[model samples]
Target: MHDNLIVIDGLQYSNWNRAIFEQLKSGGVTMVHVTIVYHEQIRETLLRIGQWNRLFELHHDLIMPVKSTADIYLAKKLGKVGIMFGAQNCSAIEDDIAMIEIMRELNLMIMQLTYNNQSLLACGCYEAVDSGVTRFGRQVIKEMNRVGMIVDMSHSGERSTLDAIEISQRPIVISHANPSSFHAAKRNKSDEVLKALGESGGLLGFSLYPFHLKNGPDCTLDEFCDMVANTADLMGIDHIGIGTDLCQEQPISILQWMRNGRWSKEMDYGEGSKSDADWPKPLSWFKDSRDFPNITQGLQARGFHDEEVAKIMGLNWLNFLDQGLQAQKV
Candidate 1:
């Protein structure tokens, strides 16, 4: 592991527990942005946050809440994992725009405009007709900028994601997704989106989820790193980081909650075929948090310098948070 690195995973929705926390420590991970809400409403979201509060109380020695860049440094100084919260969809806020700031006050640092379907704010990748950002989305983006919360476009459609990148004053991010050019996954972004993200000073965290990888469960470390290098050439090394999208220890049944939520009575396969209802087999080298070092090694072997490797592993995210998390001066 790169001991001096400030490793941060931009997104993960694992079935978190003490065991995973320990693995993060063993892997030298310092910060992680975790999903607090998918399609949950405000009350449900609050309950999830309450659950996390209990986790913090019970596992104080292992993890701490992070609402700012300073909190991340504090966690690193104490050798604890900083758990930052994010929402995979805008459902938590419902139809109320004011809830955006309220969610920020509650420590939600990142929020996606849509998940895999059309939302009040924007259109998701799975939608047949992507109308792009709605009027409410523009307002939400402005509010997010004012409050220093990141606008994430990870699961949004091409037009919607591009619209968000152009509309937001602050640089937005695709918190966890790959380039569609690599795998042609619906959730993966396009070259236009990637270029716009880089030109706009945004970031893209590569996903490790089988559905997003070019070769699914069989993707090699070399292939993954090569994709990283290729993406870096387009987006700049500073704008790329690891967001593994690790769903560790989660049961196969949870896929329904993630994809279908309450919106559909039937199971939503998302990008998966019928067999994808179950979690795909994890990459052999990165089956859990403890395997992060494999990526560091892979990056080095792919010809990235130590500093660049450090940036990809975590420092870039730290810099991004420093610029994106400060509440704008009134």
Candidate 2:
């Protein structure tokens, strides 16, 4: 059953290598959205893409760039993983709406408006007072819609996220985050936001990052599936999919780069955890891409029909991106 499924992890950042790509194949992963730049500017963003270009060149047999929905089908047919590039912050655009189209043409198809901090476009989840979308953000969203670039609010504030959904004509996405009701984490979405996301034709890719889960690294497959069930009831099953915010084999030093990102010299541990200095221990049942099948089995055990399980696993993402990746009709 799992073998025939079209598995897609909506987000993941890892120390890329032959081993991880092999793990993705072993797990039956057909495509994955990989983070390109967290806080990089235009030139740096290009450099990061160049780095991935090297990866695709070196690992040609195992992975291919996914510029459109068709690329995903091609990857599956060829038994290679389709890699979609996404910027974790709008910094690559740097207040210029034109960069959206340029980056999308470069195959950087998704860009989050913020990354846990207020940006030129919008306020991030960690902000005390949400400014919602700025004047530039409104245009950015419109231009993103005109082009094929996706507007991702995974790290955005409540007001900002809701503002984005209202402002954008295209169906945006929270590419990686869980429900606040599931864990009450600052990074998680409120029920109000989730409801609006579903109603607005957007999608929510559930995160597997331990900090976003109820029991942290000890969160069981059953507990996680229960959260999915609840979210499905709130936001239809077609609007939900997996985005294992999996950061495997990355060094602790990279944490400072992600959170601090040249803005501050301080160690930015936003939440609780004695292991805040390091990566939280991985969930025992899903330490790597190879364990993706566990989620399929867990959903089935929780009473989801095979078809429903298929959507949450990957088809939903495929269907969403099929239309989401196309340029708007003039």
Candidate 3:
């Protein structure tokens, strides 16, 4: 059961409330990389970072900030969910490589090269063309590797991802991504890219967003399990893990921001029923964080052994982080 396992969620953008923390505890999550910034939210990103810091202090019993792999293990032993602060967009640093070290000191462990749009550092997957990582992006990668922060390529353009992998002194992570072979979406990685990542010692955390799945909103837990299974078959279980990408507690306003590439957009539920009233109906897949157990059950039902399930659940991620952190030291 997930109860005795080190459950680590690769990414979550929840509203960060006591209720969500309770769900994390109940779900037995040992660590979660909570994304702090996105593409359109370029403005006010620092304010949001402060908000998360305050939440970590206020919810110290339920969560603790993780600056390194050792902190993660310590938090798990102390019965707290390790909150690894991550940036979905490097826009928070604006044009300063020095800020990377400052943020690293603040316990930001993961930094996504790009969001859904192009930035000064790299082109996003949704960009009109895959321009790849820029000159500054290469320097940024080196700084991140030198400072012990993990480089994340989840929403980066394919060319940019490849560039980062080639330039990084440490292995990077596609912290939350699906295979383009299964669903040819911009958000998914191509088979060639996946193989290259595995060969480079990088890990791919399979995502669980309905839009990224081949079946779309009608996707069942079995479909999600199959996606991970197929990825494991290709990358080996050691290089695969879960990256649910659940944004359950976020408001519809945030969703619109994500879709339209703006930070503060109004909600739009075009002539349809809404689920939580706070979010649109299309977001019904994220009913609550408590649904995580269903994923574990689905994996078991699909015949994944306890050890394999444990690796997919969190150990794989932890191992990757350990390697990445050690690489930074070298």
TM-scores of the models, in the given order? 0.98, 0.98, 0.89
Q: How well is each residue in 1-330 modelled by candidate 1, as lDDT tens digits? A: 487789999998989899999999888899999998899999999999999999999999999999789998899899999999999999999999999899999999999999999999999999999999999999999999999999999999999999999999889999899998888889998999999999999999999998899889999999999999999999998899989999888886777788888989877788776765688899998999899989999999999999999999999999988999988788
Candidate lDDT (C-alpha), each: 0.92, 0.93, 0.80
Whole-model alpha-carbon lDDT for candidate 2: 0.93
Which lDDT tens digits does candidate 3 get at residues 144-256? 99987889999888898888889988889999889998888888998878887888888998777666777666677777788788888887778888887878767766766
**Candidate 1 backbone collisions, by pair:** none
**Candidate 3: residue pairs that collide:** none
TM-score of 1: 0.98
Clashing pairs counted in every model: 0, 0, 0
Window of ten residues with lowest summed lDDT in model 2 = 269-278
Identify the runs in model 3 with alpha carbons over 4 angstroms from their true place: 40-43, 261-286
Alpha carbon lDDT of residue 188, candidate 1? 94
For residue 17, model 3's alpha carbon misses the true position, in angstroms, by: 0.6
